[model samples]
Target: MTQHVTVGIDGSVQSAAAAEWAAREAHRRGLALRMIHVAGTEADALERELGGGAELPGRVAEICDGIAAAWPGLDVTCEVQPGHPAYTLAAASGRAELLVLGSRGLGGFTGLLVGSVGLRTAARSLAPVVLVRAESGRTDAPAAATSADATSADGAPADAAPGDVVVGVEGDRPCDAVLEFAFERAADLGARLRALESRPTSHDVYTTQAPVEQAEIRESLAAAEQVRLQDALARWQDKFPQVRVEVEVCPWSASRALVEASRGASLVVLGRRTARVPLTGPHLGPVVQSVLHHAHAPVAVVPHH
Candidate 1:
């Protein structure tokens, strides 16, 4: 069966770029593209001005109709939903191969402060979410054209090495899957894979068994923890022999660490296997959401794969 990717669109230029990006991706992967928009008070007013019926579904159909016209041969569907944009988009993610949203939406704020829909979907959605910021052109172009766009996003100097595939790694089992996915992506792009482990705060409180004792034990356990992290990196390198790997351990929050590491990266890949890694969950995890919100590089979430 052909895969399906859903992109949130609200007729903004960024959203249009997202739609074009999704369409190009669908074409490349032989998949269908679905464009969705949640009817907020603002969107409702705009549709009314355009003589669209003052209803949620009508606005949705209007958006989808435009997408269908843009890429006549490809399969495209538009949906208008009620309630919060992030909630609806994240729920739709369960059925999609990927969920996409532009960094800035028809809503307010630009640059670092991404729209809530993009932020929430990236952090909470079960499907991989691609948070994109468009170039001066569209995503529906030939391979060489699209590649040039991708390269421009990376800001790579002509003589420098290609961009790397950056992924977050920790003690969770999900890190294993993340490493595997990142390695494959790096190999496919002929890029290096950079893995980072974000250390938690209260670093000295090493005692998990007894809260009081743990406070006193942190100093003793800190060095050992660093060694354990090094071992994890060594194991990953051993497993992916063909790929070049660089590992770093940082004492920053996971979100901050990811944002810093994502600089100049071709793609930032995050793992979403909350059942096995509950700390990274819907509506809660800061690290997952922060990367989605702040990273200038394109972010890719690997959902339980």
Candidate 2:
């Protein structure tokens, strides 16, 4: 089947944001956009029909219709599926280029952009899953687009130059899948790629070593970390020559470093390391959980071995 970009919609501010972001992405990739909402029971269906909330299917269709109107030639389609929301979305991820979900700032100031279902869907998704934060007052309309008509072929505001793509990589090893997605996205948008590698906080070179010796050991370790970062990115950099690369060897924690870099980023790419490592399902790591809690931009979690 032809690859497409999919976004899960529930008629919330966050879901609206995800739909717009997904539209732009689909436009950029020259792929069709699929918007889906999962409602499993008669009660759920009745709630949509009567609750009058954003989760209503008709409301979602109205939103999709508006986006399709804005992007004349963009192929936009909406579907209401029947099943467990999380499992349904996770299954949808397997068929699309990537699945996008709205981050309603779930957990408020304490945690995740996505709610419980979103978290489970993201963790279990076969392919990558992107979480988009909802902008206040944002709706089905084109308000989120930059000023000056807020319409462009790439589905972004005309003057809205894309932001840099931030990706986290381990100093000890490289994940080709994650790097590939990051570099490809950078190349597509002509955005810079900021690769981050955090050095562990524990700089315990030795217990009895003098301060000077400890300092030297720290310097040596930092150097090694830098080398590893370079080694990890060398091949990807070559593959995406047009993508400008910036390497950051952070002195802070991995989650903190990535979260900081996420500021104003077009996208933040992370590798999903899990014991199962299967397409069926996998749980999120602690670092991924923390970053999800705090990232300021859309976060892409790519499943990999």
Candidate 3:
């Protein structure tokens, strides 16, 4: 079967944004788009909260229809399944090229961008999961085209120039999958690639020592880190010569740097290690969790060994 882009819809604003983003991605990858809606067991709760009928099938149909009307000629389909939301989406991810979901649900706390379903699905999905926010213009809205009526072949707004794709690098871990995904995306979009590495300030080097000593230690550490970053990216850079890469080494927490980079990025990519135990629950690092909750742009979490 042909691999397609999959997105979970739950009749919320953020989910609608995710669907729009998925449609654009499907067009970019030359793949089909699949929208899956997993109906919850609490029908009454959904009705009371969403102000809909007892069943959610109608809501799902409405969303599908809206997307179809907005972007004509795009191959789009919808499925309504009855099961736990996170598990069903995770199963669907096995067959999808990429899985997209909203950062938060309708009833989540105001401060929480990602809900339990999104968190679990991101950790459990076999494929990369992207959490998109409602205000993400690159995905949720479109940039201006050449002409007022100009649009892409798949009906997305045509951009004069695409934005850069950014990936967070953990120097201590192997991130082949993460780098591959980032490079592929940048190549597909004809955009630039940015590799960001964040290093924490070492107390051992920056303690209450002499200013000269601290400056010397910092310079030595920074030089070493730059060399390591270059070594880590050498292979990937050779593999993707067409991709223009800009590397940065920041002296801050990885999560902070990624969150800051997301402000102007088209997409931010991160990695999650698969749990060794079969029954273990979602395992997300602090950096991934922080970016998922704070990044303004779409965040892609790729699972790696």
RMSD to truth, every model: 8.1, 3.8, 4.7
Candidate 2 residue spans exceeding 4 A from truth: 41-43, 47-56, 106-108, 136-148, 153-159, 205-213, 274-281
lDDT digits (tens) for residues 1-305 of candidate 2:
67799998876667878887888788778899998988865666677677644344666666676667666667888877878888999998889998999887534567535678878988889888999887655444542332237666655444368888999988577888899999999999899999998876674546554556777777777788887788889988888889999997989988989988988899999988645756654788888888887888899999887
Index of the highest-TM-score prediction:
2
- Residue 91 displacement in candidate 3 (angstroms): 0.6
- The model with the greatest lDDT is 3
Which consecutive 10 residues in model 1 have the weakest lDDT in total?
A: 151-160
Give model 2's clash tally: 0
Q: Each prediction's TM-score against the native?
A: 0.64, 0.86, 0.85
**Best-to-worst ranking by TM-score:** 2, 3, 1
Q: Write the per-residue lDDT of candidate 3 for residues 1-305, one digit (tens) a residue.
A: 67799999987768877887787788777788999988765873576478654344655566677677666767888877767999999999999999999875223454566978888899899999999887623332221221235577656655456677999986656489999999998888788998899987776746654557777878888888878887888898899899999888898888889988887688999999886565666678878988898887799999998
Task: Encode model 1's per-residue lDDT on 181-206: one tens digit a residue.
Answer: 67865775678888777876563324
